[model samples]
Target: MAFDNFYYCVLYEKKYSDYFLYQCILLWMCRKTKSSVTEQQPDSSAIHTISTLPDTNQYLYDFLKMVLADQKLQYSYGLSQEVKNCLYVESDEVYLSRFIITPPQTNPYDQNPSGVDSTKLIYNTDSSVSVNISAQLILNTLTLLPNHACLKKSDITYMMAEKSRLHNLKWNNQKTGFSLTNKNNWYTFSLPYFSKDKKKAFICIQSLCPGLCGSGDVLLYQFKNNKWTSQKVDSWLH
Candidate 1:
């Protein structure tokens, strides 16, 4: 029998008086509404989403490999070969604000003690090397990246995964190495922001491991004679 009908019949019985009948009606309505709602709702876990990464940019990979191969970057981590091989590159590109700087504009209301020109923007954090790319263009691209950009697995030659995977590793007694069973440590690189002429590139690379093992720096690379050479523009270590 329908619950509503059952309640109606109970309410008709004189012995099944006021409060009991009212409670039964309320309980039946709640049960019916709950069941109907459950049947109508979708199973969120069953729904899957496929996120597509950006196209493979040869220069981006080239720059990454070049920096990774740097002797300083390799040995500075103080990790053994086993742990170094476990270094996984992040699948999404990032921009490190601490390393890239926009020089103060020449607006009259703004501080202009040095009289820096607004047009002279896009400098390295130390304000020593000024890149040829428009400051606004780079800023807009970097700002939009959180919502729109990602690196594809095929775009990288190294092992690539999300940074969160670092938590899966089992640290060794010294914390400088991971146990043989652990999957990886992690490193990240900013997209290679190139000069308009494509001959100059600026990038930031960060290496992170469990505990105090880490190093990071922003570098400026100049392409010349069909080869790329880099200079440190900013640095951090631990």
Candidate 2:
């Protein structure tokens, strides 16, 4: 008999025009299995779960190769290599893959870099395949300076709210967040040594914008005399 179902998870990171965009897509073949019992009666024996299936890494790799063969994407070499590196199979019949693309050269005087055209292709398995795609900005890792400490989550939330208010930017206290992992949109904050006495320190907040294509920001703050004060710092976006 044919395979009952299939699941695919695709993730990729691309840097273009000084913006890093990461995307994840989950695809599944959605169909009900035929059972010997009547439609009105449930058949427990006919039900099969993903965990019962064997490892599907080879199948997923083959599928990806076939899918990429039909597409006309710029940087196909780099993307295909990355895809090969990221493809893996999970225990739950899930295929997860991620890849990153870096530009070959960044010289304004030289030739203009080739831009990748977006291509969409329909993948066929046993029946019809369902696709779901999610994209987010890439979060960079920040190494804390010596004698530095990270601010508490509550403090960061409050600081972000005040900053948004003063800067006239729309921010939600509940949604504005931070994380050790770069899965979602959040800012990670650390306090660097600011004074010789080490009592006062500069708050360094690093974050990526919410959308797929946006710049990252590093906000600095100083705590003195029982008040938190913002400070100006030179930041570069690339």
Candidate 3:
């Protein structure tokens, strides 16, 4: 309910009906008060002194972090609850920023990307994903790409996706090899070991990518003679 309140606040803001909003908040507060009293055993004064007035969204989230610092919060964890609610509000705001209001776009390729020496996890011997992370030079954007010509025959870096569901990898870890395949009709990175018959690994170039443009292909370097043969393998990527 608290999270719902945050979402409503961010998305509708001035549009929300005052009565409806107040009711929702009042209901949420009642639920929280009951839960805190039973679980935390706080004195009656703690409950009575607490205020339900709306506050700055960021403050709500920060307050949550402080409450969570301690292991216990069964009674009055308003600060912690508010922080979680803040995150939810932020996510909603981002989604709205992208979908409902599409602003003028920036050319992601124009910016300087992560370091050339930086290496990222492309696959982890698993089948769920294959990605390259960059960030030798931090940009305002989460990800970036280099130019197409650079992508044609160069290496690039991209900041890995932030911590998330459906995402796995030790964040900012050095380059770990990866593979991608359609397993059970689902695209997956990381191939099983000892499956010599399967595509083993996936690689990418992040030179000109503005974050992760998904340009270029996997690294398919094979040595036939004294010379090395490097091929672009994006299609071969998942």
Candidate 4:
């Protein structure tokens, strides 16, 4: 006698022997249902397994490496070498990582340096989400073009006059000076002294005109393959 459904069980329940068989079948069905439910349920440990944040210093180091590897900026700045001995990590907030780049000491015996470079990390609080890393050149007196003999006032004036002509603008003859000033004048200088290799040079112009036209610009000229090729970098001044 086969009991496939509840109706079958009821129909078969007649004699004592049949009643005993139906009772056994009900017990088996109950056990099978319990087993199936248990199999479908997820394990609590597996579901609640916790993830953690990466080591801060290591993460920032990796980030800096990637930034230095950028083809365009690396060719001009050589950030990889500059940052090798100077990278540091700290927390600005619970969710933000700060990478600080300290300048190399001027003197071997000096224990402290005055300049500091910093970049902030922006990321989601959720561990499962991706993180965004970014950095920028922090301009300062140390980062600016250093004084060079080639950056004479007369040379600056000629360069500015040529640049003005190309742009269909007038060169501010009165504003030509070595030091940066607030007046709407032209300040031209060369930073050949800053290049460790001595084969690259930077020329900067600061113009404070009456309107938005007044701004600072830099040009990087690298002596490569027996010729000088010029590249424009982002302005150090706003």
> Number of the top candidate by lDDT?
1
TM-score of each: 0.32, 0.20, 0.16, 0.22
**Local distance difference test, candidate 3:** 0.32
lDDT of each residue in 1-238, candidate 3, tens digit only: 9999998888786566776889899999999999988987867777666764453233323322332232122221111101111112234224112212134465444344443332344455564443444433344665343211211111111111111221332211112111122121211112111112212212222222123332222333333455333444333221
Q: Any runs in candidate 1 off by more than 4 Å, and if so which?
A: 1-55, 71-184
In model 3, the Cα lDDT at residue 2 comes to 100
Total backbone collisions for each predicted model: 0, 0, 37, 1
Ranking by TM-score: 1, 4, 2, 3
Whichever of 2 and 4 has more lDDT, that candidate is 4
The lDDT of each candidate is: 0.50, 0.31, 0.32, 0.39
- lDDT score for residue 172 of model 1: 35
Query: Which runs in model 3 stand beyond 4 Å of their true positions?
Result: 1-167, 171-201, 208-214, 223-228, 234-238
Look at candidate 4 and tell me the lDDT of residue 133: 27
* Model 4 ranges with Cα > 4 A deviation: 1-14, 50-235
> lDDT tens digits, residues 108-192, model 1?
5333454343444645776754434322322223452222112232322121332233323332324222243332455545545
lDDT of each residue in 1-238, candidate 2, tens digit only: 1332222111222233224322211111112323323465755664555446664333333332322232221221111111111111221112101111223434333232442223345576555545433222234356454222333434434433433333422222222221324444443322222333323333233333445532222233445696544433324332
List clashing residue pairs in candidate 4.
184-208
